[model samples]
Target: MRRLDPRPCVVAVAVLAAIAALTGCAPDAQPGPGPAASETVASPTDAATPSSPTPTPSPTEPALDPDGSAEDNLPLFTEVVEKVWKTDDRVKGRAYIDALVRAGFDKASMEVTKDRSSVGIPADSIQFSVRWTDACLVGQVGPSTKKPAAVVLPHLPTGGCLVGETRPIDW
Candidate 1:
């Protein structure tokens, strides 16, 4: 038989007493019985199973052709550019204009010029000139007199996505 040390026994009892005291002092430490067991109820053997299946919607009718004019689709281009601009300035600006021009606006016939000037002791100014596509309508944005600091001619709105009058402003 091995004999236990008194000091070890004393330490063990002290630690246990401390633990018990702590557990007792805890706010919600009562060791109560858990919730009662759930009651078992009888179920119908031949109950019809519930079903939920969404009906597929009928396909939407296709839009009619607007006389094959690019001008008719101007609103679409404006909406696309607006949405693109919300998240991407670079994409909404020069990149969008380039895409429109490349996609057939290169032959725009109307010539529009924009001139910007900052009035102050030390002056700052710029100018730009652009051409409108014959296939659609006017398409230009920039300085009017000399070369502009930058120019971007994004697609304009016609009468589909949104209705608004767009005008160039000098600032």
Candidate 2:
């Protein structure tokens, strides 16, 4: 009778044990959920009851303006401006104005600085604003500016969107 080789058997066992340990299949490891049972499950009587359908607002319904005051809408305006501004570094003046317009700001009441200067040099900063009844919601973004900044300040009694300097939107 040929003698059985125990060396090969020991090496094979060691390899399998190492694989199991590496794969987290140790004997004490907890098992996860298996396939669902073949039996049909039953729900409680209360759970099976049908409830009245809730009415959902239509998509065409206009969204409620944030209190209709620029001060009250400062936070919302800031959030929207930040989201739009971060989308691209090369965003132009019209992009910010358009985004604010889409966010329910009146286009006729909005103003934006040109992306370039009178000499056609790219502006270091750009400003956009919405002229509200008593105040203005202004947002400025650019290399010279910190993160997207927004503010609600009293409208210039002189009749302008912002009090600070802003380039003309010639572009």
Candidate 3:
């Protein structure tokens, strides 16, 4: 019998497993009810299970976790970012800061970039952030970005998320 290489076979199996995982055919997949699934009465414990975060806000608002990881609060953070992006002040850094404050994120924990450049031209984008524990929830929006985006990122070694100068969240 001819000797065969095992590495190629291992790589092929890994690729297949990844494809299955992404396509939801993996053995450990645990998806929630589909759009057409019928709703039924459930025990109190099962009533509001959040298996995965929804892109849109739920009928009942999600609250910020004061001590939880930044990733856990990203859905709410993204909701606020998206909400602000739909408004007339989408490019205004202050609008993002105010909305985040109203949404219950700490004003002291936030930082935002200027809406305009030193020469007074409108900036291509604005970045805002809220520090949560050891992580930061960062958001960017404006003409350059084309769409609002939010994500959980690790804090910089020197501290804070935005570089250069950031304006105060003072009202």
Model 1, residue 10: displacement in angstroms? 97
Q: Model 2 scores what on Cα lDDT?
A: 0.74
TM-score of each: 0.26, 0.56, 0.64
Task: Evaluate residue 68 in candidate 3 and report its C-alpha lDDT on the 0 to 100 scale.
Answer: 78
Q: Residue-wise lDDT of candidate 2 within 19-132, one digit each (tens)?
A: 988889545456766547985555696567657766876754334275667777776678778878778743477877767777777777777777777788887788888888
Top TM-score model = 3
Which candidate ranks first by lDDT, i.e. highest? 3
Per-model C-alpha lDDT, please?
A: 0.39, 0.74, 0.88
Clashes of 2: 0
Better-scoring candidate (lDDT), 1 or 3: 3
Return the TM-score for candidate 3, rounded to 2 decimals: 0.64
- Candidate 3: list runs displaced more than 4 Å: 1-60
Candidate order by lDDT, decreasing, is 3, 2, 1
Candidate 2: C-alpha RMSD to true structure equals: 13.6
Error of 3 at 50 (Å): 26
Residue 99 shift from truth in candidate 2, angstroms = 0.8
Model 2 weakest lDDT span, ten residues long: 59-68
